[model samples]
Each structure stands twice: as C-alpha cells, then as structure tokens.
Target: LGIGGVRLLRALGLNPQVFHMNEGHSAFLGLERVRELVAEGYAFPVALELARAGALFTTHTPVPAGHDAFPLDLVERYLGGFWEKMGTDREGFLALGLEEKPWGKVFSMSNLALRTSAQAGGVSRLHGEVSREMFHHLWPELLREEVPIGHITNGVHTWTFLHPRLRRHYAEVFGPDWLRHPEDPATWRVEGLGEEFWRIHRDLRAELVREVRSRLYEQRRRNGESPSRLRQAERVLDPEALTIGFARRFATYKRAVLLFKDPERLLRILQGPYPVQFVFAGKAHPKDEPGKAYLQELVAKIKEFGLEDRMVVLEDYDMYLARVLVHGSDVWLNTPRRPMEASGTSGMKAALNGVLNLSVLDGWWAEAYNGKNGFAIGDERVYENEEAQDVADAQALYDVLEGEVLPLFYAKGPEGYSSGWLSMVHESLRTVGPRFSAARMVREYLALYQKGQEWAGKARGEQEVLRAFHQALPAFYGLALRVEVPGDLTLNGEPLRARAYLEGEVPKVLRPFLEVQLVVCRA
Candidate 1:
C-alpha cells in the first residue's frame, strides 16, 4: 500500500517535498523513497537521511495493542527481496523496527516510522505526553518533556458534519465566506436566532426519529420477530424528548457500559418529569469478545429493565447514521477510561452541529470544555483502580443529568424553546466550531510541512547560505504598513483610492523594494 501510494503520486506528474505518514502502517513508504534515491546514484545511508529529513509521522494510538507489529520471520519472508534494492543487509533492515517484547523480539511498525521520520507527533496534547512516556525507551537519555514528540489535535471537516440548514443559516448571517473563516470565533456569534435554531434542531431530530424507526422495523423483520414487536419499534422514541447519542468503536476502554453502572438511578431519570432517551450506535471489533460482551450487556439491560422505549441500540452504525445522530441529537455522550482515549473526533462532529457534549474529561474534551458549552462527567482525576474510577464516573454522570442537563433542557419559555439551553448551543458553536475544525488543523500541518522542507533542504546542503542570511537579519526586521481608504468606492467599475503608510524605520536602499496596491474582494 505504501509503495503503490508513492508510485501513484509520481504517475500523476507530482513530486511532493514532504511525505506525511499518518501512522506506522505507511512506514514502508520511507523505504520506497530511499530506494528511489538509491536508484538515482546516491549511497544508501545518504539516501535514507535525505528521505528521513522530509518525512513526518503522526501516531494516533496511546495503547500498545493498537499499534501494528509482526513477527521477525514474517517480515523477512515478505520483505526479503525489497531490502536488497536499498543496499542494506537483512539484519540492518530488521534493526529499524526491532523491539524486544516479553514473548520475543518483533518488528514494530511504529518504531520503524519513528526511526525514518524527521518529525513525529501525537494526535492530542495529553496523547503527546502519554506517547513520550510510552516510547521513552527510544530516547532513554532525554527527559520525558524533552522528547521530540509534539501534538496536533485531531479535527473534523466542518461542512461534512454540519447540517445543511445550519449551513444555510450561517451563510445568511455571516455571509458565504463564513466557512472560509471557520477557525475565527467571530464567525460564530449566533444570537437572537434562538427560536429558528431550535426549530431547525427539532426538525432534524424528527427526521432522525423516522430514520431510527425504519431501521429498527427492518431489523426486527430480519430477525423474524412478531408483528407486535415490529410495530413497537416505530414507537420506540419520542421526538420531543431530550436525546443523548453514543456512537464510536465500542472498545473496552471506551467504557460504553459506564452509564449502566447504576441501573436504578438511570431508570429514575428516564421515568422523570422531563422526557429523556438514549440512542446508541456502534460496532465492536469482531475479535473483541469483551467489547461484544459490553454490547450484549447493554441490550440485555434494555430488555431486563423494560426501558427499550426510552433507550435503543441501533445496529449497522455507518456514516449516514453518524450524520443523522450528530445532526439530530441534543447531547453527545462520551465515557472513556481516563487517558485511554488518545483523541476522539466524534464529539467534535456533534458539537459542530450545536449538540452539547456530556463527556469524561479526556481526549479532545479535556481541552475544549469551558463549563458553559457542555457538561463534564467527572473532574480530571484518575483513581488508582479501574473499579473505583468507574463507580465515581457513573455517579457523576447521573448527578449531572438529574441536576443540570435535565432541568435546563426542560426549562422552556414563551418562545417554546429553552433559552438557557440555546445559550449553551451558542457557546458550543462559538467555541468548538473554530478550534476543532479541519481548516485549522490543515493550516497547522502546513506549518509543520514548511519546517520539514527547510530541514530537508539543510540535509541536502542547499539551505546553508539562506539560513545564515535569515540569522543575520535584525530582530525588528521587515515593514509594518497599513492601508487607508479615505472615501467610499461604488461598484460601477470605479477605481478605488487608497494610501499605504509605513510605520517603522527602513533603510534608504530598501525604499525601492516596497510597493503597495489595493486588493478588493467581492462579497
């Protein structure tokens, strides 16, 4: 996959200066790049160095099991002829990924990528720290903080997750270029549109209810259930009810069953004065027995407590259902074991559509939550044991639902919408919209790519003179100029008049180098 991807790029008449490996799965690209340089008459070591200088690797998982590793014999069997092209012996090639585990030595793909990349990072700030400690052995002499691993938190594409109605509303208020400036907080100052916003959200929620009912009915028919059971599926949830959504990979550490820790308390909330319902949709790995067991336990509890109407587990969770849930749900629920979640992006998607997040203080939530936007399950405290942590988090979850989330949601006004709840929706949009957008993420990555290019140029001895010139410049260098428009210009093909004023001292020789022009943008 790695070699084919690089070759495909070359076939398109493109030669990228920077190679970004999303995870260790693509580490083989580094070897393929080195081989290209070798074929061009460069020595193996020099080729490897040049390839490494322009490569960036981003590690996504904090758990060891999540990373890919293979037996030494397996690697040799598959890559036997490949290493000959790079002018490296079998032992030398294997040493790039060699790691001594308790069972035996294995070839870790993550290790290979780390060895071959010039820059490496984790997906979030907390993940970065955890990664440094996890891989500290690779740089034993350096302090944990001094380890070279940086962080660029994951983000979701705003338009992909945003509801079309909301998108239109934003375009109407903030203009068509609103998405172009999604990272700017000023672009999301949603106010006085509370009634319309609630109406759009409720409409989406109604559509979601229809979709869920249809899916549930079909599922019962496939299982050969009774007509009465199929009919009950249609009436499973209330469209007016406050809905909480949970959807992601049902990994054990994600603690999907944490909400069921105290079934009696949960039942009370479900049967309380205000209506509430939960919509769960996710799939566990086929090999993960424990995760499957958690799913089974959740289904069993829904039947055992006879709360199927108030709670549901949607089958076949796909991107379509994900969009429905994120767009329609009132709250996004996440309960991962502390520090186990590297950086989850599901909540970010939900938040983009104004769904409040009720999550444990882990992953992206650890940095995004500001008390007003969403509710936290528990404080950022990790217990010594798993049992204790689970118990505390479950209780905290119930407390917040009963004490805060429920009351605010049900507190409606003359406009037939909860003003307080809409305030939170506004805050969630204003805060999460800008900071956790793919637009911002791509910009941050571009900066890293530029740095990688500079490093790669240095490795090839092409940037020494440029580096010295940059270093020789004064701290207070370059021009500080502002443009002023004295009069309003009509759009009747009239040329606009503007003046440029330089605010800082400049050398006489540099005067001719400065030129200013007026740039106009059509709205």
Candidate 2:
C-alpha cells in the first residue's frame, strides 16, 4: 500500500526530494525508489546509494515483537515480482532485509528500512539509544553511538487538541499572535486569565460530565442492565470535584492497572476530605485478551467497591471523548512502565489545555517535566524485577497524590480557586506548550532533511574517495574506548576527569574521515 501510494504520487509528477518513513510499514517505498533508479540505467549499488541519500526512517517500536517481519516464502509470494524489476536475483534482494538468525529466514521491515535509509531514529532520547542497540547488527560497521539514528521527541498538534473554550480564552487574552508564534512560549499568557480561566475549565468539566452520563446510560441500556442501575448513570461524577483522567490504547506496557494496585489505598484517597473522581477510557486490541481482562478487572473493582459515583470507565473511546477528557480533567494521568513508552503525546495535549500532568518520568515527560511544572510519579530507579518496580511505583503514585496533588487542588480561597495549583498549571502550559507543539516537530524534521541533503551533495562526484572510506568503515567501527571514573560527585560542584584507553585500529585509507569524541553527560 505504501509503495503504491508513493508510485501513484510519482506518476502525477510529484517528485519528493526527501522521503520519510514514519515506521517500518512504509519501508517498501525505498525499494520502489530503488527500482525507479535501476530503470534509469543505474547499477544496483548506485541505485541503493541514491535512494538511501533521500530517505529517512523513524522506528517507534522499542521491543522486538513490535516490529514487522515476514518469512522468506511469504515475502516471495507477495513481493517476488519486485526483485526482477529492480534487476536483482532473489538472494541479492533478500539480503537487504534478511535477519541473521540461526533458524528459518525472516525478512524484517525494520532491517530493510535501516539498510536503505540515509538516517533512522526513534521518537524520544531514551528510545533512540534503545533503537541503536536493537538495530546494531544491521550496522556492524558502526558503534551504537555512531549509528545514523538520532531523536526528535514526538509532539501533539496543539490547535487540533485545545478545547474551543480554551482557544477562545487564549485569543481573547493574548490576541492572535500566540497561534502564529506557538514556538514562543512567552506568547501564551496565563496571567489575567484568573477567574475566567477557572470558569471556562469548570464549564468544560460540566460538559464532560454530561457526555459521560449520556454515554453510560446508553451503554447500560444496550447491555440490558436493570432499569435502576441504568438510571444511576446520570449521578456518576461531580463537575466541581477534583477529577483525574486516564485514557489511551490499553497496551499492557502502559500499566493502566497501576493505580488500582492497592485498592484500599486508592479508595481511601478517593474518600478523603479532598475527595477525587476519575474518568477512565481506553480500548484494548481485539487479540489482546490479557489487556481486555485487566481493563475489565479495574472496572469491576470500581463497581464492586461502590465507587462508581467517583469513577467511571467510558465505552468506545474516540477523539471526541479524548478532547473532553484532556480539556475537562484536572489532572491527566499516565503511568507507563519506564523506558517502554515511545513519546506518549496525550499528556502534551492535556498540558496545552491547562490540565496538569501527573505521569511517570518516561517518554516526553522525561524531558518536559520540570519539578515546578508537572509532577513525576517516582524517582528514576531501575529495578531488577517488574513486580518490585510496580510495587514501588504504585506506592509513589499514592504518595504524590495524597501529599501534594490533592492538598494543593483542594486548597481553595475566598475566590473559590486553588491559586497554588493554578500557578503550576500556568507554568506547565507556558513551559511544555511551545516545546511540544507539532510546529516545533515539523521544524526539526525539515532541519534533518536539509542536513541529509547537504551530506548527499558532498558525496556526489567523490565516489572513489567515498568507496575507499566506506570499505574501511568496518575496522573504524570496531574500535573501542575504555574510561575510568570516580564513584561519586557533588551536584554542580566538581569538575571531574577520567582516564581513557583506546583499542582497535582503522585502515589507513580512511584516516582523513575518522574522528573520535569523548562526551560527558551534563544531564
């Protein structure tokens, strides 16, 4: 489908100077481009080189199973015709995507993309590092750090996600400049919004509550629940209460059940003086029975404990429902397992709407969470076991909510506003709003394309020099460095130096193109 789309565009005279693959699914486009080049009398190597120079691939998966791979026979059945057209035999064509397994042959789309693209990347900083290690076999000629993959943190389309009421308020207060200059964080004003901000938010919450009541009533009627139970739907949540929302695709790694880990603790928090309500919505993949079961368990627990008045899991999650949750909820909750989430953007949407995020320090939050801007779930600790990690993180979630979030949210004054909490909301919007906008993401992608084009231009007509340099790249990649460091250092206090040793040798032919870098992580 991706190749067909690209070919169709080309047929209409749309020549893309830089082709970007968001994930492995679109990798076949690179092969299609190669076939086009080969038709123009270019050798396979030259075709591959030219096609790669104009290609960029971004991989979002952090786990092996998440990638797409097909067996050789399957690929032969589907894409066999592509080989002859590209002037390659089956063996030569298969080499582009073949996995080096000791077992049966499989052609990995990710491998194909990595081999055919000038650059590749993951969605976030940590994911980029993970991707380099995962795809190292594809680039044995380069160290993980030297792998062409880089990162541009994912972002949300702010204008699309911001609630209409908030949008109007922003325009009224800051005028039209903020929309055009969204990259300028200072342009978004939180001052003078004051009571008007809370009023708009209160109205959004009321709207969300009404929508939830209508949906719940309809769902009960469709499921044939008792008339009395169906009638109870309208009384589900209070618009004035402290509301937290959790909604996303129910992938197991997202840990939606983390909040329900300690049922009694959660109940106590909900039943406290500063009582809170939760709005939950998500859908599991049809084949993901465990994910479906986990979601059902939480919903069942909510009903079994008579907490339905304080919590409700909406059915059939969609964009409309997502807007209500993000715009209406007081806090947007995300608790994905550490290092597994690849740049979750729902929290960014929520932040732009002036809803504060309370998430695990993972994905975009790893970079966006300033201590003063948004709340983090736990310390950055890597546990040996998932069970231990879950327990520790669950406890941390409860602690933060009880000790900080709820207290501040309920600390209302004569003006009927939680000034302290509102201040944090202002800071969150001012800080993360601009940083995680789609405008910024588009700029980063264009910059990457420009950089790739420049490098491709540099290599043209220098093929003889490049060929020798490329031949010696494997030996250069095999080189290793060792460093010794002190066990501990003070925060912003010490200038530290480490002893280093270099190992391995590169071929003399590529000395001019080789350089080594030693970096210290200031973060």
Top lDDT model: 1
- Location of the lowest summed lDDT over 10 successive residues in candidate 1: 467-476
Q: Taking the tens digit of each residue's C-alpha lDDT, what string does model 2 give over 214-257?
A: 99999889999998989899788998998899999997888887
Model 2 scores worst on lDDT over the 10 consecutive residues at 458-467
RMSD of 1: 13.8
Question: What local lDDT score does residue 194 receive in model 2, on the 0 to 100 scale?
Answer: 83
Each candidate: RMSD = 13.8, 4.9
In model 1, which runs have C-alpha deviations exceeding 4 angstroms?
Answer: 462-523
**Top model number, TM-score:** 2
Model 1 reaches what TM-score against the true structure? 0.85
lDDT of 1 by residue, 1-523 (tens): 3888899999999899899997756998988998898797766677777888899999999888888999999998988888889877888788888888999999999998998898999988888988998888888867787788998998899888999999997787778888888888888877745777788999999988998999999988999999999999999999999999999988889988898899899889888898999999999999999999989988998889998898889889999999999999999999999889999999999998889999999988999999999999999998989999999999999999999999999899988888999999888888999999998899999999999999887877843443343343452266577778777667677776778877776654444544555545578
